[model samples]
Target chain A: MNIQALKTYLNCDNGFLLSLVQKFVEELNDTTNKITLAWQNQNLTSIKLNAHKLLSSVKVMQLKELTLSLEKIEAGAASKHISSELEEDIKQLDIQVKKVINDLQLTIEELEANSPCI
Target chain B: MVFKCAIIDDDPFFTELINHYISQVDSIECCGIYHNPFDALNKVNFQEIDFLFLDIEMPEMNGLEFLKSLTTLPPTVFVSGKTTYGVDAFENNAIDYLYKPVSFARFSKCVNKIKAHFEHTRTNSQVKQQNIFIKHNGIHIRLAVDDIFVIRAHDNDVTLNTNVRSYKTHLRLKDIYDMLPLNDFMQVHRSFIVQLAKIDKVDGEIIEINGRTIPVSRTYLGELYERLKIK
Candidate 1:
C-alpha cells in the first residue's frame, strides 16, 4: 500500500497521516459491515449511504479500483435493483475491502514504527 | 481575515482530511465538525460561522434535506463522494460541490471562492448600513438601521417599531423594507416586516418579538422560515 500519494494529497507530515489512516483503519470494519447488512436486508438507501461513506475514505486511501467499485455499488443501490450482478459486485467488494483493510493495517504499523525515526 | 467554517460529514476520515486542509490555510479555520447532520442541525448557530462544509448523504438526514430544513444557512459547500449531487448542490445555492477525497489543491481553490464571496457581501453590507431620516409627529427623526425592529403598513402610512418606541411615517411597506438591511429584516406579512434577529419565538403562523405577536402570511411564511435561524 503506497501512502506517498495519500501523504501528498493531504500535504501534511507523517504524524497527521498516521493519525488519519489509523482512524480510517479503526472504523473501516463497522462501515463495511453496515454495507453488508444493508445489502442483506435489501435496504437500498442504507446500502447507498454506507457505500458512499466508505467511498470517502477509500478515495483518500488512493484505491482507484475500490473507489470505482464502490461508486458502482452506490449507483446500483440507488437504482433499487437487487440483481445477481449487483450481489456479485457486493461480494467482490467485500473481499477487496478486506484486503484493503489488511494493507491499511500494515501501513499503520509501518508509520508507527517509523514515527520515532521521523 | 480568518473566517470560521464547520464540517458536517459522517465519514470521519474525510472530515479529518478536510480538517487538515483547513488548518493549512491561514485565512480559514474549522470551528466545528459533526458526524451527524441531526446533531449539527440542533447545535450549529448559522450566524456564527461564515460558511459550512456539508456532506450530502448521512444515516440521519441527507445534506440537501438538512440544508432545506434550515431556516437560515451560511454559504455552504457540499462535500460528497457521488458526482450526482452537483446540480442539486447548486440549486440549493451551495458555494461549491467537492467530490470526495478532495485534494489540497481543490480545497484551496474552494477557499479562494468563499473568500471572494464573503468580501463581496461585506462590501454590500457596509454600503447598506446607513441611517434613514423619516418624519414622525411632525419631526424629522434620523434612525439607525439597527434601531427599528418591525415595520407595519396601515392605509398609506407605515409604523416603524423600535426597541424604545414606535414611529409612524407616510411611506409604503415595500419602501420601508427597501430602506432596511435585507439580511437583518424579512417581510413576514404584507403589512409586517420583522427584523429576523429580533424574533423571540414563532408559533405556527405567528412570530413573537418583544412580547408582540406578528402574523406571518402564507405568501412570505416559507421564506420567513428560510431566512430566520429556527431552533
Candidate 2:
C-alpha cells in the first residue's frame, strides 16, 4: 500500500489516515462477502455493483492487483455469464481482498505503535 | 464569499473523502453531508446552497429521481461508481460527472468549473439589476432602469418613455412593470406605470410627469399619495 501517497492526497495526519484505512478494511471484508454471495446466486446486478463500489477503495489504496481484478469482475457481470472462468475470477478476488485486509490490519498496527496520537 | 455546498451519497467513505477535499479548499464550505437523499430533502435549504454533489445510486432514491422531483435545483455534480450514468447525468443537466475513486486533482477541476459557473451567473445578475433590454425597431436596446420615466399601455403594446427617447414594444404594462424596481415605479392606473421621482403634480384625478398628463385611478390614488408622502 502506498500509505505515503494516500496520506499526501488526503492531507490528513496519521490518526485520520489510520481510521480511514480501518474503515476501508471493514468495508472491503463486507463487500467481498457481498460479491461472493452475489456471484454464487447468479445475481449479475449485485456482482457488478459491489465490484464497482470496491473498485473505488482499491483505487484509493493504490492496490493495482485488486483494482484490475475488481474491474474484470464488474465487466464480467455485463456479459451475463455464469461460466467457470467468471467463477474463478470471483474466487481470486475474494482471496486477494482477504490478503489486502490482512496487510491493512498490519499497517494499522504499525501506525498505532509508531504514533501516540493514534 | 465562500460558496456553500452539500453532498448526498449513500457511501460514507466517499462522502468523507469529499468532505476532506472541501476542507482543503478555501473558497468552499460543506454545509451538509447526507447518507441518503430523503434526509437531505427534509433538512437542506436549497436556496442557501450554491451547488451540490450527488451520488446516482442510493437505496431510497437515485440522484436523477431526486432532482426530478424538485421544481428548482442548484448546480449539481454527479458522483458515481460506474460510467453507465454519463448520458443520463447530461440529460439531467449535471455540471460534471465524476466516476468513483476520484482523485484530489480531478475533484479540484470540478470545483473550478463550479466556481466559474457561479461567477458568470453573478456577473449576469449584476448587469440585469442595473439595466434591462427591450426590443425596438427590430433590434434590442439596453436601457438603464434609472432613466425610465413612464410606461403607457396601448391595446397591444406598451411604450416606455425614457429621458433619451420613447420606445414602444409589444408587451403588457403589468409584465413591463414587474421588471422595474418596485420601490421606484408604481402603477397609478389600468394602463400607466410612472416613476415616482418623475411625478411633478398629483392633482385630483390627473398626474403630470415629464410634461405629459396621465390619469390616476381611485384604486391607486391613495397608495400613490402615501408613496409620495402626501397626507
Candidate 3:
C-alpha cells in the first residue's frame, strides 16, 4: 500500500495517519481472530458479520486484493457452506492483512525516527 | 466570524479524521462532536449550529432517521462509506454527500458550498436597506423595520410581530438581532427584542408594546434601562 498516498487521501499528517493505521491493525487482528474462531465453531453468521465489518476498513485503506478476498468470503458465509474455496480465500486474506500490518509498522517507526522531537 | 458546526458519528476514528480536516479550515469551528445521535439530540442546541456533518450508519439511530426526526434542521452534509445512500441523502435536502474516506479535496468542495450558501444569505439580507426580509415558505417577504413591534424567540423559531401582522420565520433570535438595525432595536430579554420606538410603556419588570406584555429579564434590564436613558 502507498502510505504517502493514503496520508494524502486522509488529509492528515504522518503521526495522525500512523495512529489510525495502528487502530486499523488492531481491528484487523480482532476481526481475523473472530473469523477463525467462528469458522472452527461452524458459526457462519459470526464469520459473515466479522468479514463484512473488515471489508469496510480494508476498502478505506484501498486494499483491493484483500477487499475482493474478504467480499468472496463474506458472500460464501452468507449462502454457501464453509468449503475449501472459502477456506483458501480466508487464508489469503489473513496473509495479506499480516503483511500490511508489518508494512504499516515499519512506516510508523520510520516516521517517528525522522521527527525533530525524537 | 467563523461558522460553528457539529459532527455526529459513532466511529471515533471518523470523527477524529473530520475534526482534523475542520482544524485546517479557519472559517469553520467544530462546536461539538457526538458519538450518539440521541445524545446529540439532547445536548446540541440546533438553533446555534450553522451546519452539521453526519454519518449515515450510526449505532443507535441512523443519520437519515435522525434528520427525519428533527423539526427544524440546519444545513447538513452526510459523510459515509456507502454510495447507495446518495439518493436518500438528497431526498432529505442534504447540502452535499461525501463518501469516506473523505479526501481533503472533496471536503474542501463541501466547505466551499457552505461558504457560498452563507455568502448568498448575507448578500440577500443586505439587499434590503430599510426593510427586513423574512423567508416565509420559499419566498422572502419584505417587512419594514418600522412596523415590527417585538421579535420573540421560542425554541428554533422567531416571530416578528408587526403593527399590522405577525410573521413567523425559522431563524435564530441572535441571527435576526444581527440583521436588524442596531440603533432602532434593543434586545430587552433573552427571548425578546423590541423596536425602541414601539415601546408603549416600561414597567418595573415588564414592557408593554401594542397590547403584548413582554417580560424584561434582570440580565438584560440594565442594558435596556441604559439604552432607553431611564434613570
Query: Can you give the DockQ of every candidate in the order shown?
Result: 0.61, 0.33, 0.24
Give the per-residue Cα lDDT of candidate 2 at B78.
Answer: 94
Q: lDDT at A17 for candidate 1?
A: 83
Among residues 3 or more apart in sequence or in different chains, the pairs in candidate 1 whose N, CA or C atoms overlap within 3 Å are B71-B226
**lDDT (tens digit, per residue) of candidate 3 on B1-231:** 356789998766667778888988766789899988999999898867888999887655789999988997678889876698999988876888988767788889989988777766666666455887899777899988888889999987999998888888998886887687756787777689899888888999899999999998775677778888999
Query: What order do candidates take by DockQ, descending?
Result: 1, 2, 3
1 or 2, greater by TM-score: 1
lDDT of 2 by residue, B101-184 (tens): 888888889888886776565555453456888888889999989899999899888999999899999876755765776668
Clashes of each: 1, 0, 0
- Give the residue spans of candidate 2 off by over 4 A: B128-231
Evaluated at residue B197, the lDDT of candidate 3 is: 84
- TM-score attained by model 3: 0.63
Scored against the true structure, residue B62 in model 1 reaches a CA lDDT of 89
- In lDDT terms, how accurate is model 3? 0.81
| lDDT of candidate 3 at residue B2, scale 0 to 100 | 51
Write candidate 1's Cα lDDT for B1-231 as tens digits: 356789998888888888889888766778899989889988886755778999987887889899889887568899887788899888887888898779898999999988788666655755666688888989999998787888888988999988889999987775566566757777787688888888889998999999899998766666777777454
> Which residue runs does candidate 1 get wrong by more than 4 Å?
B128-231
What C-alpha lDDT do the candidate models reach, one value each? Answer: 0.82, 0.83, 0.81
